[model samples]
Target: MNIAVSIAIPDDEEKQTELSFDELSDRAKEKARDNYRQNYPDDGWWDSSYEDFDKIADMMGICIATKQVPLMNGKNKSVPAIYFSGFWCQGDGACFEGNWYPEKDPLASLTKVMGHAPNDADLHEIAFGLAHLSERCNQLIPEARVKVEHNSRYYHSNSVSYDIDLPMPIHIQEGNELQHMVFDGLRTKLDLDDEAFETEVSDLLRRFMDWMYGLLEEEHEHLTSDEVIDQYLEEMKFDEDGEAIY
Candidate 1:
């Protein structure tokens, strides 16, 4: 004969209900995101990354414009005209209003910062593009001024306009057949007339902006990854039902 016994478990009013492990993990993630936003609002977390970008821009011979800002010490500070928007949604990217000149050795500078191989195809292409454009400017329109301006409400490459003001093209005297022929030959060799030069400049700026967007995206992903978020949540306290405790 077997006896069955039923025992009543006493209710503990002080005890709190614990969430499932998965639920707790999700809550931790939410808390981590909230903490990130509070700590680094308005994408302030990208400051260091932007500094790196500034270095790259300098390497590429991009002279970003600066403005004076009043400081606490009654002095003014200069800030570059770099602008950027972020990781998700359409028309979100990086751009700037600045002047671009050909660097003596942009490939070398890129290699130094990016660790790209010297013979890298894309590297060569970018260097060549800059050099070619500079050459065209020098030969055809010495007094040309190229300004990159961010135009649209968005920050993507399409929103950036490359305005090339060819104030003076090389002028030859009438009936200077020889000089005209030489100029024509140079233009043909470079394959860059005024229109072509504009197109090329637009393409190059867009490429650089794309690269910048990639860098920003990478930085954002690293900052928001699960591992990073977990580290942020390590010191925070949480209550039993997956709610964070103040």
Candidate 2:
């Protein structure tokens, strides 16, 4: 499901065959400006209240939404699921939350729903999909970026249990830095005596790109509702070896 749609800018078809991500971002910015003018056509549009950067950030954030496509042929059958979604700006700082879903629910991970240990391939696919989504949104709205995949690990004992915040693949943009400090703080939670495993940023991006290239070589299947799959899983029973026993 790591698919991307090409966004076109007006009057550029002759010169450029395909629009770049940066081009789309510029187009989005223009669209936002046009939206402002359309909403307020009179002189009151230039009121001092509009000068507030925080308000402007919120307005810009509100302007963009994930493109939705129909799942089935009938009307009102379309459902949009965001693999990764977040919005932020200079005055407002940054707040991006991203999650990869095995199916329609963003909160449900493959390991959780499938009740199996995650393999390298599964983790790679999830991270790659989220990375592509992050790139897609980042190009459109530079400030709308997700740098970290947030999750938690639980440690349990007979009497008590504790939860620790963990970090997944995190990407850093070289240039056009925005809200770096705030995002850095939010990326990973650390304690003075706490220990953690850190994944190399380069390795994560490389895996993501590798996954992207593989998608180009394969044919994608049109997926239907996951209700049938869910039912099957519900009926399934597993053994100690994690194999389906029934």
Go through the candidates in order and give each one's C-alpha lDDT: 0.66, 0.30
Lowest lDDT 10-residue stretch of candidate 2: 153-162
Q: What is the lDDT of residue 31 in candidate 1?
A: 61
Please identify model 2 stretches exceeding 4 Å from their true place. 1-66, 70-76, 79-216, 220-246
Clashes of each: 0, 0
lDDT tens digits, residue span 1-246, model 1: 999999876787556654432446665557645655555434356667666666656765667776565767999866666677876787688877788765555456555544533554554465466665665556565555678988888887788777677553446766888887877677667765677777877787778777777777887778777677667556555655435564
The deviation in Å at residue 215 for candidate 1 is 0.7
Question: What does the lDDT read for residue 234 in candidate 2?
Answer: 42
Please tell me which predicted candidate would have the highest lDDT against the true structure. 1
Clashing pairs for model 1 are: none
TM-score of each: 0.71, 0.19
lDDT of 2 by residue, 1-246 (tens): 899999877784454233322233444434433433333334332223222312222222211122345435654432211122111222211111222211222223233422332454644354444444334333322232213332322111111112323322256455525655544444433211113212332233334323322332221111112332333334444333323334
Clash pairs (backbone) in predicted model 2: none
TM-score between candidate 2 and the true structure: 0.19
